[model samples]
Target: MKIILPVAGKGTRLRPHTHTRAKSLVQVAGKTVLEHIIERLKVLAADELIFITDENGQQIEAFMKRVFPDLNCSYIVQKDRLGPAHAVALADPRIAEGDDVLVVFNDTIFVTDLTRIPELCAEADGLIYSKEVEDYQRFGVNVIRNGIIVDMVEKPDTPVSRLAQVGLYYLKDANRFMQYLDQAIQAGDTVKGEFYLPAVFMRMVNDGLRFRAPEIDAWLDCGKPETLLETNRYLLEERHSCQGDLIDTVVIPPVFIADGVTVRGSIIGPYVSLATGTTVEASIVRDSIVNADCQVKDANLRFSILGNGVRLAGSPRRMNIGDDSLIEMDS
Candidate 1:
């Protein structure tokens, strides 16, 4: 099977931080968003990994090469930036005929047992993962008949189906998928000037392909600033470990302190992640994520996110500060 990741999004919602770095590279729970996604993909053991990135996606390429050196991966440039269908279509040359394809979006991290994939695909034409969410209008919901997905309605007025597509798919016939994707693009079957993968899947559904919508274990979105922090809080529960020896520092449970992090005269945690090279002194920090190489002195922070190389002093408040910022709050 080939794993295709469309990671070319500019992340317009995650401003400031995204202005200087890719959204997938944003740090949360002491790991990058892409790293967390790669952790999930390690179970797949795919034949070849294809990343659809933009022309200016060198940072992603470099980070992947440096961190995941042994990965058998190739990068495809999505020049037009049309939509999901266009992104996956760029990998057509890499996907051979009849090869199984797993398409995953990079803006979110999902937890699903992929061990049953091969077995499930053997019986079905495709597989879609979804989570039952209360906000049905916010997503394209799966319309299921009996046991298979019959249609997908985007932002329906009524609560048709609570199963929201969590941006993960497994197609048994990659060649057929590309055909539908091409058809969607050529027929001008676009929402607003961009082709989407859901339309292609709908076309495939109309042509007698069976798609099973399984219940996903979890779907953690890192699309925007608020969601990123929520994802951080979620990850910290599973990855709670500290590699630091501090003095005059108090640590609560469920926090991640990376190596080279210094915490002195402070109480940190309940849900927090302090990245490497960060120092928290004379402060009380909780429910937040502080990125690498930051200095937090004489402050109390909560439900905040500090990007890399930020320096904060003399404050007690919440923030969404970005990289390399220096803030000296009033006493």
Candidate 2:
């Protein structure tokens, strides 16, 4: 199977953090968000991993080379700022007609048994992974009928279906999907000056192409700040361990304290993540994410996000400080 990841979008929702770095490269639970996504797909043993990046995608290449040197990956830069279909279309030269392409978006971190995908999609034309969400209006809902997906609605006004289309899809015929995508582009099938994947997929659905909408276990979105923290909490619940055995610090379960993280006389977590080179002294931190090279002292930080190289002092009960920012609160 060939894997495709369209990661060229500018994360406007995750500003301040995304202002300095790519959204996917942002640290969560002591590791990058991209790392978390890639770790889940390592068991699939795909043929080649392709990343559709942008011009300033040097950081992505460097990180991937350093972390996954032997993964057999390739990178292609998408110059234009088009939609997801445009980004995926840029990789057309690399994929063949019979190749099975698995397209996964970078904004989401999914938790499901990806090892069983090959066996599950053996007889199907394609697979569209979704999650059953209550707030169906916030996401694109899939209309399934007779055990197959017949239609896809984008953020419907009414509750047509509860199956939210989680940005994960498996295309059995790469060539056919590309052909349809091209047709949509040629036909000016766009929504507000941008081409959408749902339009192309709906076209295919009309042509009698069967797509099985498989419900995924978890769909953790990292698009915004609140959601990003929520995703971090979910990840910590599944996989988290302290590399450093703290003595004076009040360590809590389900928290990730990376190596070189100094925690002195502080009450941390039930849900907290601290990266390396960070020092927390005489503080009580919980439900927060502190990046690397930060210093927090005499603080009561909760529901806070201190970016890289940030310094927090005094008694900031709650915060949303950015990178390299020095925040002094009222004691």
Candidate 3:
């Protein structure tokens, strides 16, 4: 199967960081979100990985080349910020007829038994990975009937089903899927002036396409600053284990300190992630994510996110500073 990664969104929710890098490049637990997705895809031994990117995605291409040099990959430029379905359609020419496509969105970090993909694909025309969410009104949810996905409703006032559709999908028939996309676009079937992937699935379901909504173990969102930091903490505690060099510092558990990080006379963690080359001096940090080459001196930080090369000092306070920033706060 081929993999399609739609990373063309401007990541407006994760500004500042997204201004310089793609949303998928945002680091969590010492690795970019894209890297985390790629690591999972590698297990499938996909034939080719197709990336749908936009103008601000040069860094994504460069990072891919630098990191996964040997992986079979291709890129397609989505000139217009149309929608998820539109972005997927941009790769139509590259997709072979009757090919099974696995589409994964960049903003969400998901964990599941991927080995069941083949089995799930065999039983349905398409498979959508969903998670049970309490706020079903805030998401597009799958309406399942007799264990088959009958419809998908976007933020309905009345609860249809709690199976909120996450950003993972497997289509057994790529050609048919593209045909549906074309029909939707031609018919001007749009919401808020953008074509949505879920609408296409709804159309397909009405036309007798069988879709199965499978439950995933975890669906961690990294769309905003707060959620990204929360995801960082969860991933560090659950997925990775690291030890940083602490000099006269009080270290907390469930923290990830990449190599080259130096903490002196500081108290760090219970959920902090410090990237390589970061130096923390006489500070207290917890529940934060500090990127590479950043310096935090005498600052007490909590629930903060500092981008790369940020130099933060002065009277110890929480901050959400971006990359290459220099700030001084008064106590």
Candidate 4:
């Protein structure tokens, strides 16, 4: 099956990091978010992979070429930042009539078996992955009836279900789905003049397109700053086992320390992730995330997220530090 990944959305929420790198390339637990998606798709034996990107297309294209050199990958630039539905429409040229296309959002990281999707597609015309999240109103919520999608409400004030779309979708009939995309865009019934994919899915429900829901094990949206840190912590504790390079430091298990980091005289983690070029000196950090080129000295921190180039010093007890910030702790 062919796969379409829409990575074009400029990550406005995830600034600084997204400013320098593609949102999909944001690293968590020492692996880029896109890397995790590509790995999972590869396991499913995805035949052709196409990326729809915006301004950061060149960077993503270069990165994908180097990483997945053997895969049949192609790139399409979306000139206008329309919306999700329009982004999928950009891939219409490459999609064939009978091809089954899995449209996955680039920002979502799924650490589960996507291989089961083919089987799910065999039974359903379209399949969407949803998870019971605390904030359902922030996501597109689907109302399913007898394994068929009956209605899709996008960020309704009162959500009917806690099941939120996890940004991964499977379409059995590529051409027909693309036609719905066309209808949604041409109708101009869009949110903020940007055509949304869920609207078409709702139209599909009325047209008997049959959408099924599959509950995924885990899904992380790395778009928000706080969620990025949370995802880092979760991914570190779940996937990464070892922290590279250490000296005179007591590290509890389930910590991720990136390369080129120098730690001396520190007690790190029940859950901690230190990015590259970070230095921790004579301090104790637990359940904290420190980004690259940051310096932590003589501090006791817990449950904090520190961004890149943060200078933390003195006897500071607890705080959340932003990037390129200097926090003079209480000595």
Per-model TM against the reference: 0.97, 0.96, 0.97, 0.88
lDDT for 50 in candidate 2 is: 89
Least well predicted 10-residue stretch by lDDT in candidate 4: 236-245
TM-score of 3: 0.97
Candidate 3 per-residue C-alpha lDDT over 1-331 given as tens digits, one digit per residue, 9 for 90 to 100: 8899999988888878877778899898888999988988888888889999988568878988999998888999999878998998887887897688899998889989888887876878989999999999999999999889988889989888999989999998888888998888888788898989988888899999899999998888999999998788779877555556789988787888988999999898889889999999999999988999998898989988899999998855567777899988776
Instruction: Rank the models by TM-score, top first.
Output: 1, 3, 2, 4
Task: For residues 130-153, write the lDDT of model 4, one tens digit per residue.
Answer: 887888878888887777678888
Each model's lDDT: 0.89, 0.87, 0.88, 0.81
Of the pair 2 and 4, which is ahead by TM-score? 2
lDDT value for candidate 1? 0.89
Following a full C-alpha superposition, what root-mean-square deviation does model 3 have from the true structure?
Answer: 1.2
Candidate 4: C-alpha lDDT: 0.81
Pairs with steric clashes in candidate 4: none
lDDT of 1 at 279: 90
Query: Candidates ranked by lDDT, best first?
Result: 1, 3, 2, 4
In model 3, the Cα lDDT at residue 135 comes to 91
Off by over 4 Å in 2: 245-247
In angstroms, give how far residue 173 of model 1 lies from its true place: 1.1
TM-score of 2: 0.96
